[model samples]
Target: MDPLLPRPVQDLGHYRLPSWWTPGAPRWRQALWLLVGLPLLASELPGTPWRQWLLRLFGAQIGAGGRLKPRLRVKCPWRLVVGDHCWLGEAVWIDNLASVTLGDRVCISQGAYLCTGNHDVRSPGFELKVAPILIDNDAWIAAQAMLAPGTQVGAGAVVALAAVASGLIEPGVIVAGHPALVVGRR
Candidate 1:
């Protein structure tokens, strides 16, 4: 018996795709997103305003005074809504298979990932699941923080650096650590 032997079965190793799968956009829009939209936004050539404009052109609802840094990987601009005076730092990845809404004054710091999609482990075919992520007004998702699907950060809440947040973070609470426990209140 080899210690490095593989598991008898792996759901994802031999998974099959569902017949009804789609990229959530029409073929033309997906082509444009892949060809032009993602590349432009990921580049440092565009200034903050131009980047915002580009995202808007691809159907993102962006509000005033947004400071968007480069190297962002946004899965679908159509599923995103960013509010006034929001700041998104470099390397922020929005893997929004579902909707992601950020309220006014929200700040998503560097290297933060907001993921709105996951795969179900129980299913033999590895079924995909998606849910919306909501970050309310004045909330701060600190650097390197990872927000899981269906996570909601309430108004004035803070998800500290390197925190893995899921479920609801109550208003004005500061959460930290994996599975993000409430550490303080703002």
Candidate 2:
């Protein structure tokens, strides 16, 4: 079901159930993401091809001059979108149970995890919860940072090392500390 479809068209398109759309993501893609992610996570050095292959195989909209380091682990590879000139550094785990969007020239440094899913502990079913994470162009996520669910990192923003990003990081600013707070201009 296309999200933007007109209501009448949506209703007429056939009542396609969610179960029909659900499937384990492509195996080849999973292998690719893991192939690149494991080495980057375990090793001290960088492997560009491995990372690139994974991103490409998983259908990410990665542009030329992009460098995804080996340590990045991306779940549901098909849901990730990375733009041109982006850099994903070591130990970057993107748990894209939902969607994770990265704009052009974005830099995600070492040990940064972009988590998009959580458990709905409040519900009796204890189901998996999800949200979208958006990082705009020219953003820099420094070493060991974590971006929580539904958070948006604006353009030209710099999130400092070891920061925990919970909400929105405004555009053109520098942020640091847990639940990252605006610090200065980027």
Scored by TM-score, the top model is: 1
Candidate 2 lDDT, tens digit per residue, 7-91?
A: 3332323433344234246666567556764444445556676666655655766677877675467777678888888998877
Residue 168 in model 1: lDDT = 96
Q: lDDT scores for all predictions? A: 0.91, 0.77
Which sections of candidate 1 miss by over 4 Å?
1-9, 13-22
Best by lDDT: 1
TM-score, every prediction: 0.91, 0.76
Candidate 2 residue spans exceeding 4 A from truth: 1-46
List clashing residue pairs in candidate 2. 40-70, 40-71, 41-71
Candidate 2: C-alpha lDDT: 0.77
- Clash count for each candidate, listed in order shown: 0, 3
Candidate 1 accuracy as TM-score: 0.91
